[model samples]
Target: MTKIEDVKLIEIPKVKDSRGNLAIIEKDSLPYPIKRVYYLYDVPSDAFRGGHSHIAQHEFLIPLSGSFDVIIDDATNKKTVTLNKPDKGLHIVPGIWRELENFSSGSVCLVLASDVFLESDYIRDYQDFKLSKSR
Candidate 1:
């Protein structure tokens, strides 16, 4: 079973220059190899996203602009984490349920995924997720 303790906050290395600041995420920095990349943007304040759990996918979430809160549940305990900076990322392991909420306007959430899109890997029902965690 997965636990909230398995979640990690990783600091992305930043290069500061007069022109601008840049942050980088390498394969070695993550627990799983990157196979997919996606971003969330223009989310309304009252909206919620990501009410699902992955059977095998690992993810690293970064707030590139603005901020938001991520609620992670291992079916036994739950925790909320805020992402407000580009230099920080939340590493989410498999078998944990995650929900993204309270997105600030113009927020851009970048997700580095361990695998490509697969419908069969997602557990969309919360009850099903809880049941799976027990087994």
Candidate 2:
């Protein structure tokens, strides 16, 4: 069983240059080996994404551009995180529900996953997720 405290804000190594800055994420940056990489862009400000929890997957979310808020629920408590920096990432473990909202226009969310797409691993219903945590 994962707790809300388990969610963490990860800092990516950033190197500043005269013109711009570069943030990097190597294999050592995460706890799990990333197997899938995806992103979300052009999200409506009032819309939500990721209203579910995974059974076995872990994810690292980075705001590559603009900003957004991630609502994390652990069946016991809920917390909101604001992602506005390119060098910061949110690390999320399994057995916790998450929803992304308040996306600024042109915001891009990059996700690094521990596994390939697996529909069976996702718990989409909020009620079912709470019950699973109690077991």
Candidate 3:
């Protein structure tokens, strides 16, 4: 069982330059090896995404462009965080429900996943997630 308090923000080391800046993620930056990388973009301000919880997979979410809110719930408690920095990411463990919303214009969300896509690993129902937590 994982607690909502276990969720955290990971800071990616940024390299400063006169031209601009660069942030990189290496093995030392994450607890698991990333197997898949994806992104969300062009989302409407009124729309939301990710209303599911993973069974065994972990994910790291970063706001690559604008900003958005990530509402994470652990059946018993919930916490909302806003992401607007490219060098910071939210590290989410398994068995926590998450919702992405309040996206600013031209916002882009980058995700680094610990595993490849597996439908069986996802519990999409909020009620079902609650039941599982009760177990």
Candidate 4:
């Protein structure tokens, strides 16, 4: 079974130049192969997002512009992590509930997933998720 301890902070490689900075994310650098890539932005400061758990999808979240906090619940304990750097990512494994909150204005959240979008893979109900974890 997956636990909160499985969540990790990953440091992405960054290259600096006279123009600006560049960070690279590839399949080789991640624990799992990347199958889908998406980003979230223009989130309101008072709004919250992502209150679900995945059954099989794993994700890596990166703050490309500003900052936010990710609240992770493992059905045993809850932990909060702040993402504020472009060169770092939070790795979320399956079977854990996550919520993104306290997003700063203009923050951009980049996500890389281990699988394609599948509605059947998501556990959207908190009560249902808790029961699944106990089994």
Predictions: Cα RMSD each:
0.8, 0.5, 0.6, 0.8
Query: How high is the CA lDDT of each candidate model?
Result: 0.95, 0.97, 0.96, 0.96
| TM-scores for candidates 1 onward, in order | 0.97, 0.99, 0.98, 0.97
| Cα lDDT of model 4 by residue, 1-135, tens digit | 899999999999989999998999865999899999999999999999999999999999999999999999999999999999999999999999999999999999999999999999999999999999999
Better model by TM-score: candidate 1 vs candidate 2: 2
Report backbone clashes per prediction: 0, 0, 0, 0
Model 3 alpha-carbon drift over 4 Å, by segment: none
TM-score of the candidate numbered 1? Answer: 0.97
Which residue pairs collide in model 1, if any? none
Model 1, CA-based lDDT = 0.95
Candidate 2 C-alpha lDDT tens digits along 1-135: 799899999999999999999898997989999999999998999999999999999999999999999999999999999999999999999988999999999999999999999999999999999999999
